[model samples]
Target: MFSPEGPTLRELAVQALSSVEHGYDLLAPKFDHTPFRTPDTVLESVAKALGPLGPFEDGLDLCCGTGAGTDVLAGLCHRSVTGVDFSAGMLDVARRRATGPVERVPAGPGTPGVAWVRGDARALPFTAAFDLVVSFGAFGHFLPRELPGLFTQVHSVLRPGGRFAFPVLAPPRPASPAFWMLLGFDAVMRVRNAVWRPPFVMYYRAFRLGQVLEELTRAGFTVDLRALPEFGRRDGGSPRARLVVARRPDGATPPPAA
Candidate 1:
């Protein structure tokens, strides 16, 4: 669902047909008005979950589309907060918004200065520089096969004992309408990629939690899952939302490539 200021149907169709980078570039200006942008409620919940683990020095927001996650880092990190993404258009919007008067986490005297960098998440352009790294609503753009390399990159950029945090929602039950909606969305995306060139890689069902935890462990992170109380619990008593906090072990380096 999109607001009146969001991308039109024709604009969305054009974006869906383009490469992921180009599609996001096309969508950047109106992204906040679209449901694709991470919600404030989710951001607030993540900020609350991360509050105890932090008082961190430097932070990075991986795949930081329009810098929503950067706002979260600004509150938690003390020294600096950087937002990195592959899309120049998204960075432009983020930069502009950062200078604007938009409502965001209150930046106190110790609040870190924010910066935006254009870089691919799979090959982030930093090394052991950040105490914390976060991502929001960007995983679907990455294929399942790419998870190991991606996690490795996140690991490489974080200082030993630093964390990579992000929130994940529990998958909907098979009988639910939301389940069918996501399944159909992924199916359509697969079909579109099969028939199109410069494939737009966005699939809702590809990032399984078990596979992610394994890859994070293989990448040298001790993973912790914290339930977000704001979203409550599912019918089966599992958390509706959980924050995946993967910490690179103290004084440890990334694992050697396979």
Candidate 2:
């Protein structure tokens, strides 16, 4: 589901052969054209859902590739917005396309500012710097074992009462072709990692909802799930998508070392 201007098959091959950082660097220019970039619809829906929750002061867009979610942060946060990603190329693109004048109406405004930083999610550069943090479509890059550390880092950067929120879509059913497609992708990734160096860890099936919630709780967040009703329920009445809001309790101490 790529646009006409997206990366070619050759480019994809080259990227897949490289390390995750290098691969994302190579793909940065064409990332927005690909389906890998979070869609405006989903971002808008999330913004709408979080609209009532905010009036947040400072915001951070974690793993903010090419700054898609940064816009959402700008809309939700009052003071300022910052986007952080590991890929320098992605940060470059984000700065180049940065929004200068802030729009005011619903979310209140005073010259919306944007900043891009190159950093690792597991070791954030800030401590209690943001009132809210939101990530989009970046969890697949992290392995299951890395979740606790990653969540802890996010927790460390958030002020008390601050939230670490993101959207979680339900996995496709085993009977569905989409499920098989993802399964095949994960299978290929496993084999690739076994034989490759500097492995690129991206598996759609690795991040389970139950495990994620428990980890958030372990990280000292008060967790809650809000169904995104824009995308309707499934056949069994399960929500098609959900927004997970993990808030660090007000006045909670620093995240314990893992």
Per-candidate count of clashing residue pairs (backbone under 3 Å)? 0, 0
- Model 1: worst 10 consecutive residues (lDDT sum): 99-108
**What tens digits encode model 1's per-residue C-alpha lDDT throughout 8-125?**
9999999999999999999999999999999999999999999999779989999999999988988898878889999999999998988523332324667577878889998888
Estimate TM-scores for all models. 0.96, 0.96
What are the per-residue Cα lDDT tens digits for candidate 2 across 1-258?
778999999999999989999999999999999999998989999999998998798899999989999989888887778899999999888887776533222333454567788899999998788999999999999998999999999999999999999999999999999999999999999999999988988899999999999999988999999999999999999999999999999999756856
RMSD of each: 2.7, 2.7
**10 residues in a row with least lDDT, candidate 2:** 100-109
For candidate 2, give the lDDT of residue 28.
Answer: 92
- lDDT (0 to 1) per candidate: 0.91, 0.90
Candidate 1: regions farther than 4 A off: 99-108
